[model samples]
Every structure is written in structure tokens, then in C-alpha cells.
Target chain A: MTQPAIELDGVGKRYWKIQERSLLRSLVRFGPPNKTELWALRDANLLVEPGETIGIVGRNGAGKSTLLRLLAGVSRPTTGTVTTRGRIAPLLSVGVGFHQEMTGRENIYVNGMLLGFGKSRIDTLFDEIVEFADLADFIDTPVKFYSSGMYMRLGFSVAMHVEPDVLLVDEVLAVGDIGFRIRSLDRMREMHRSGTAVVFVSHWLQAVQLLCPRAVCMHRGQIVFDGPTEGALARHHELLTSDADSAEYARGTVRVENRQLLKLDGSPAGTVQQDSAMIYRVELHFDESVESPQVLFQVYAEDGTFVYQMQTPLGESWRTLSAGAIATLDVTFLPRFGGGGTFRNVVVVTSIDTSVTYVRDDGLAYFVEPRIGAAGLSDLEAKIAIDGVDRTESRPMRFGGTWAAVEGA
Target chain B: MNNRSLLISLAQKEFRVRYKRAWLGVIWSIALPIFQSAVMVFIFSRVGRFGSGSSFNYAAFVLAGMVPWLYLSASVASSTTSIVDASDITVKIAFPRAILPLVSPVANLFTLAISVLILFIALPIVGASVGPRFLFVLPAAVLLCAFTATLGLALGALYVYFRDVKFMVQAVLLVWIYITPIVYPPSALKGAAPWLDFNPLTGIVGLFQRAVGAPVPSVRALLVSVATTLVLGVVAIRAHHRHDRLFVDLL
Candidate 1:
């Protein structure tokens, strides 16, 4: 019923790579001077509803940062339009626009104002922000004297309290220690509950999978794929493998002919159920005779976190393979991740001599759909009846989802 | 609070940070320009034999013109370079990019205000008594700030595109004082006297001199300063508003 919080209509941005930035050189460089045009984004169209959480994944030059800059209104789109309702907050890194000489308390007002919050708003939120940052003792101390973690915590706390309609978080969640990271995630989850749209961009696939339900995969300045988070991640891993394989394949002796993910019933599986067995099967063709070879299998979550790893038994010597031989390797595992998410499985083949690696393949990916009312990286499913008394139960959640918001764009 | 409060807050930060770790603190704001004025008063009045036997005290003349001159030069010099200097914030955060340049001039206002206070107090010490005519100092200060902000916003916006403008501003400010008739009255110059009347700051300094009961500048010079400030002010606001959202690209 409500208008989407943010919309980009045919948005495009281009930057010039000037050969010489100086005024004098530019004057002397004559007609059609030395410069190149780089289109950072092209025809980027997106619409985000309120309380939607969207993830952006891309390689280095895929223009994710440029898109954020445009959405934040820090940079204007060269063409097209970016329209958004209400305030847009860019979850900037620590000390952005902060005066280091000012105390944490002072910086909060200044930073909050710079981010477009009223002074009275910051005043009321000040104590809660301090408690959240856990910097009660250092509130009056100059930020320059605060540790980097403390500085980031104070920054994160103030931004978290702002109640933005749309929050653009760019890899700022990995701040502080693990505890702070979790707390920050929890706070973001809270914002999600209260109806804020979050545009999160991160290379950490696991975090992306944990938080965002939908994602857009960007490649070479355009959205190559946009759908469920797992599908986007699967597409991304394929891009990475294909990108990496082209340069490395020329020197390898063994080639991965084909790769497939199969269920326990031996049917090719594109998506699997939670707690079901999955076989990461790779077909390899050898160009040269090889002695006992070891095969390595690794599973990575959509956030690129290594979820599982195993290898063929170290001392179990498989028979030698003559030249022009084909080998089929199967890696079996039970997908323990709950709630549907993408997982990438890599297959590597190497000789026992430890001097040569035949092939390293990471192109295969599969999805696991978690059970109802389940969450987190794994489905522990802790169930017990201790002497006829049971206490394990989940109360009705005020926040309906793991992260309350639904992400798009 | 709105941008008005944000502007004041930002300026307050610039003011506080300048004195943060220094032992001399706000004293430096008063001391540095006073020290410069004292040295100039000695050199031009006694050593160079300028402004001698004049109806006004050369010391008061020098100190009065010196305070505003210092504010103009320092504010312009720093504010021109501010947008580029704070690229870290400019690149990441989204707000009015003009705020970056606007903050420094306002931030330095505290120092300018403090120095002006020191000037009023120093006037009596130099045998220049306070007069009701000194009320003109309020308009003079406003005119001075208008001139500074116009120039600052215009050049700060320019500096984002052409970084070498920073050095150009510094080079100009270094020589601007000598030409503004701070130590000697504008009448002291010969052929350049007519040209000096065209310099916008000439009337500003003249007004500052009048604020402390020194010699009055011609009406033409005062009119020129007002016209120039308004014209440049419009141009600056236009330029900055057009480029405000685009400045981050260059950074």
C-alpha cells in the first residue's frame, strides 16, 4: 500500500579518468585531450519497499560503490533519476565527519546533525546510544584518544539510533570484536523490525545470507542476476570460478570436465532440503599419469564463509591413474544449515607428491531450504525429554523473521 | 535543530579543536594577531616613518585593520582548501557538500570575534578613545564576513575541481594585506590610490579604521565594497548550489 522507500529509474553514472589532473597539463594537452570515460553504472532500475533488506554483491569494478553514492545523494547520477522518501543514511565508517578532538558525546551531536538528525532527537537518544556503544566511561573523552574499536562503536551506536527510512550499510557491520558485530547485527535486526529498508553490500556471503533474503549480483556495471539470496550467490560463485579458471586453466594438467550436486537418491539436485545428504560430485580428466591423488572438498555459505571441509583419507592410497584417464570423485555431506540458503562446494585434485595441483574447481553451488520456524547457520533442532520434563521452546517472536526486513535491489 | 544549528555546531567544533591540546589556548587567538600588529606598528610608525604625526594613532589603525585583515586572509586561506582537505568525510557521507567549506569560515568566527574584542580593548591602550561612531564596527564586521563567505564558497567550490586553486589563494592572501592600505591610509599611494579604491577590501579596512575613530574612507570606496559583496555573494551562492551535490565526484 505504501510507496516503495527508494527507487532508481534508469539510473546511470559515468566517471572520467583524466590522464593529467593539473590545470596546466590540461591546457596544453590540446583537442580531445587525454582522458577515458568509465561508465560505473548503466540503466540501474530498482524499487525497494519499506522494511525490505537487499544485498548487493559484485566484483571490484561492478559499480556497487557508485550505486550507493548515488542512492546516498553524495553523487548525482549522470543520467536518469534516484528518488527516495524520507531520510537516507549511509552507515559510514568510523570518524566520518567526526572531529577527533571532540569527546564522544560531542561527536554524537555533530555526527548526528551531519547525518540530518535534529539536535533534540540526538539529545533524547544520547543515553541509549551510549549504553549501546558500551562507552559510558569514555563518553567525555576526546575521540582521538579512544581506541579504534571504541571509535567505531560510538559511530555505530549513533547511526543505529537514527531510525532512517533507508539505511545503506557498506561493510560496516564487521566493526569491533565479534560481540560488537553480533550486537550491531541485533540492532540492525531491530531496525528491520521497526520498518526500515536496508541496502546492505558485503563480500561476506555468510553475513549476506544470514541477513538478506533477496540480493542482486552485479557484474561489469550491471545487475547480472537479481533474485533470492542463494540464487544470487550461486550465480556469483559461478562468475568467480569462470573468472578465475580462464587464467589458471592453461597451466594445469588435470581439467574438471563436469561438476554436479546430487541428492542421496542419486538425482541431480539444484536445491536440497535441510538435513538431507548432498553429494558434491566432480568428473576429472587427467592428461598425464599420476600416482595416489588426494581430492579436497569444501563447502562455502552464500556469504563466502567456509562452512565445511574434508579430504580423502590421507593414508588411503587410491590406485594410480595412467595418462588420459578419467576419475569421478564424490563428496557426501548432510546439509545442516536451516532456513533456505546457498552453499558452494569446491573440488580440488592434487598429486600425492605434493608438488603439483591438477585442478581446483569451485563453480558448483546448491541450495538448502530450512525447516519451518528455523533460523541461524545450522539447524541444531535441540529436542529432549529430561525425566518427563521438557523446557526447550521458543516464545512468540515480536520480530517475525530472523531479520525482520525483506531486502530487495 | 536545523542547518542553522548544525552550522553553528560545526563551527564550534572547528573553534574548539583549534585550541584542543595547546597550552596557550584562546590566548593564541588574541596573541598571534596582536603580536603581528605590535611588530607592524613598530616597523611602519617608528622604523619606516609612515603614518607619522597623523590625526589618528597609527597603532590603533594598524591593530584594527589587522584583526579583520587576519580574519579575512586566514578564513579565506583555510576555507578555500577545506573541501579538499576533508575528502575523507566528503567522499563517504551525504549532506550539503557546501557545509564543508561553510564550516571553516564560521568556525574561525570565534577566533575573529575574540581578536576583535582584543582590538577594542587595545584601542584605549594606544590613545584611541572609544566613540559612539564605533557602532559602525557591527556593519563593518558583517560586510567583512559577507566578503569572506562569498569568496570562500566560490573558491572552495572551485578548489574541488582545480586543486591548485589552494596554492593560488595562499599566494594571493600573502600579498593582499600589503595592497589593502592597512598600515598607511589609502591617500598615501599615488597613481595606485584610484585603483586601491576599487579593491573591495579597501573599503572594508577603511570601515574598520572608522570603527576605531581612525580616518574615514571615501563614500565611493564603501559603495564599491557593498556592491562587490552583494554581486559576488549572488555568484557564490549560485555556483555553490549548482555544484554542491556534484563536488564529491572530483574528490
Candidate 2:
């Protein structure tokens, strides 16, 4: 059997959370010192074979970003070690290391070298990078003048051209238009097919499902689940819908004393699909007196966009909810709203008609894997036709060819 | 893998991008400092009556001091901010973090070389005889750069964590000009001159003056400066090697 391209054993990182901003003040302070230690990751172990596409799914602050940073070798592991055999290319946040004053062409060289490319290799791949970015004419203009889409496109272009042996992709794919997003993903797939080990960190489960056969889910700096993408995602969904899901947050005025995603018959239903006609009944037990109680539920697409929101009637429903009272609110809809990815629901209990919020239980994520050739978070049953003749119904419409290979041609 | 070549390439990149937008282009590097030296010559000779001695033409004297002082100050300022400014790049890519701070000295070399050449031509016109002794300026310049690199690398690495190192360097630089013997001859300090030898840069400036027929630095002062530079250089390299990859986390 081939050796794993990358290996991590008991890896961890510790951060000193400095309470004071200025360095001078810390020199003399002796009383209860203003500092805290945060273990961003601990005892994490993984072995990835070459060409394996692994997805990392977790809530915010779950150490997903920290794991990517470690793999990129941008920071040393405070404990343990990480070993990798080939060149690493990290597609971090949007416009990572791009100089605003530099033109697109100049930035390519700078970025290329930073990613461990030799000058000769950069020279050979120069035309391909520019062509992939589709900024043929605007290459000479300063990057500051480029739109946010153009900037991200250029950054993604450089990363893809490096032909990295190990690709570390953070959620930077969330930016750019839908078209470019699909193109970049296809490019990543091409790299994966050619034996580039890939680790993708994203909150969107659909993107993970589509790209990664295996995945790992992190919770509070620990790997909660690791296996097939479906199993990891199922555990992730359980973490979202479980009774103990978001109640663990230490901050905030009101705590989700209790939460339940129930079926119409009041039975616990942990799994919900994209096309299921399911009623999402969210019952929140508040710990404090929330005046003019308004429970808000927002659903996000795989790309992290606000696809839709459902809130209890603003002025009319559940006024002045007393402390310790269980406020069971229900949202029944035809689950056809999302396209095909992981959808996260943020259950927020706020003061009606005011910006003041009382309780928020985040990280309630679920998976929605629609049938083949579906688009986006929810299938909105979008029908396109010419003079009443349905295009999709009659024949599979070609939305241009696959974007990666045919891009330059 | 080849650090020297990578450093040279990074340095070239820094120079190209820095002046890419200027209307006068790369010539601005040569023009701005020459203009400043010209102004200093006029002030000291005409208004300040700042001649160190009758035999010494104040123009040549001021040019010697101005060129090196400018090199030191500009390089220091650039080095202090180098890591912080390149935080964007460092946080993403893996390379020698020291390359960021080294960029200042490398780019400033162009302007530094020009000033040295200008001083060479002005020596005879300003009443100083030119000889092979002038060749000492080459080693002196090299020493000055090595010293700056050691100091800048240490400070730039430290500043990533402490953050106050940048401002502290700024404050020290403001007062450092007066103490470095840049604007006056070492003899002008008189009785205090012996103690002032402790300053590392004092010996460097003294070396430049010595090459140009000014007073040779006391043996004690020369030893102190060279020692300080070597010690600082070793400490800086150790610190950088220890903290190179970790610096990006803070950035």
C-alpha cells in the first residue's frame, strides 16, 4: 500500500490570549496576570493518502481554520508534529497576500514564489495562470481596481496553476459569483484526479459531499467524527439537532436551556432531506425573561449565503416570555427551499421589534444531498423555457461545458 | 533552498514595486537624497558657520555624514515596518521570514551606492585629497550593512509579538541622529568623545571619516563598535531561527 502523503500525530497548538493590548503594561503587572491559554487543537491525528480529498466540517470557532493553518506550515505545532512529502499550496482567505498596488501580472510572480514555485516554473505557467483567471486585458491594471470577484479569481488562478502536491483550501470558495465558484471547484477536482492530496475546510456540507469522499468533523478543538463523508456529516447533523447541540456555549445572557427539532407528531426527527415535506419545530427554553420574544431561524446555502429566514410573527406572538418558561415555536415548510448542501439554522431569541438579542444557539447544521445534477442550497423548482416549452424537462440543457479544461480554449 | 538568490529576488521585487508608480520612475532614488545633501551644504557653510576646521571644506564633511546617516535611518525605518506590512504574505506562504526585513537594506543599496559615488567625486573639489585610503569606505559600508541587518532582523522579529518595537525603534531613531556624530566631528564632542565610542554607529561613521582623512577613531571605540555589531548579529540570527515560522501566527 502507498504511504499516506501527509501525517499528523498528536498535533496540537496552544495560544496565549493576551488580556492587555500594549506590551509595556505586561512587563510590570504581577497580580492575577492578564493572560489565558487556549488549546485550539489537541491530540489530533490524521493520515491522508495522495489524491484523497478530505473535507473538514465544523461550526465557527471549532478550530477548522487552525487546522488548515497548521497544514500550510504557517505555524509550528505547539506539541507533536506534522509530516508531508510534497509541495503545499494553501488557498486561504480571499486575496491572500495580494498586493493592492500591484498589477495582476506582477502579483502572479510574487504569489507563485511564495507558494514555493521556482522562477522557471512560474515563467512556464504564466500564460496558463492569466488565461485561467480570465483577466486577459485587465492583467496590466492594478489589483486595487479589480472587483472583489476579479481579485478572488486571480488568487484562485495562481493557486490552481502551482500544481501543488498537497492543496489546503479554506472557505475562500464562498466568495466570487456562482459561475466562478463552480469553475474553481472543477479545477480543484482536476488536481485531485491527478494525485494532489486535498484538505478542504468549509461549513457548507453540500460542497463537501460533492468533492470529498471522506471527511472529519471537529468540535471544540477535537475531532468529533472521522470517516466516510456521509457518516461524518450524519454525526455533524446529530451535533446540530441533538438536545445538547448549541446549549454548550458559555457566553451570552440567555442560554438554550433546551432545544428540540421535532416532527409534527412531537417525535424527535434528526434527519431531514432537501425535498422532504417536513415541519421544523424548534422549541427553545429561555433562562431569562425575554420581552416581546421573537424567535428567528435563518437558513444558509452551501456557499454561506442567507438563502432564507423564518421568524415568528413580530408584534403578535409570544410577548414577554418569562424566565424558565419553555417557548416551543414551530416552522412548517415544504423543505424544497434548499438546493443541495449543508444548511445551518441559527436559533435566535430576541426582543421583538428591537436589535437587543437574548439567546442564540448556533451551529445547528444539517445535510441536504439532492438528486444528481442539482444546483445550490435548495431546489427552488426553477423552470426555464422558451415560449412555454420547458428546457430542462425536454432535454438536459448544456450550461456551457465544464469550466476547468475548456476555460482557455 | 538558495537563500541568497531568493533574497536578491525579493529585494529586486521590493525595489521594482516601490517605485513602479512614480512619474520620474527609478531616478527618484538618486535625486531626492542628493537634493537633501545640497541643502545641508548650503546651510552649514553659509548660515550655521558649522565648519569643523579651516582645512576641512564643510561641503565634503556634510556629504560624508549625510549619506551614511540617510542610509542608516531609511533602512531602519523600512526594516521596522517590514514584517508588519508583509504580514499578509508571511501569514500565507512559507519562506524565510528574515527576507522581509532584509529587503530594506537590499533596496536602499541602490541609493546608498549613488550617494557614495557622489561623495567620491566631490572630495577633490571640496579641498580634500583623494587617495587609496578612500578604499576603506567599501569595507566600512559593508560593516554598516551587516550591523543594520542584524539589528533589523532581531527588531522586526520581536515586533511581531511585542508590537511596541516598531514605535520604540522610531523614538530611538529620532534621538539617535544627534548622538551618532552624523552632524558633527568626533573631536567636536571633546572630553565626552571617549565615552561616546560606546555607540556602535559612532565607530562606523568614524571609519567613513577616517577613509576621507578625518580623525581616525580611537582604538577603544573601534573595538567597541565591532564587538557590539558582532554580538547583536549573533543574537539576532539565533532569535530569527527560533521564531521564523511562528512569527506568521501573530502576523
Best by DockQ: 1
**Candidate 1 stretches greater than 4 Å from native:** A176-190, A256-274, A281-352, A356-409, B53-55
Q: By TM-score, who's the top model here?
A: 1
Where does the lowest 10-residue lDDT sum fall in candidate 2 chain A? A395-404
Could you give candidate 2's per-residue lDDT for residues B55-74 as a string of tens digits?
A: 55567767787777889888
Task: Report interface Cα RMSD per prediction.
Answer: 1.4, 2.0
Fnat per model, in the order given? 0.71, 0.59
Clashing pairs in 1: A52-A406, A53-A406, A53-A407, A54-A407, A119-B1, A205-A302, A205-A303, A205-A304, A206-A303, A339-A370
lDDT of 2 by residue, A1-409 (tens): 8878789999999988887756777677778887899999988999999988888988778788788878988788999898987889999888878777888987887788888777788889999999888999999999999999999999999999888999998878778888888788778868877889989888756667667778898888989898877778878877655634543664555665444555566676555665555555555666777777777777775457887887778766556767777756666655564346666666777777747877666645566665445665557576668899866543221122232224446
User: What TM-score do all the candidates reach, one by one?
Assistant: 0.86, 0.85
What candidate 2 gets wrong by more than 4 Å, as runs, is: A21-23, A241-271, A281-333, A342-365, A376-409, B45-55
TM-score of chain B of each: 0.95, 0.93
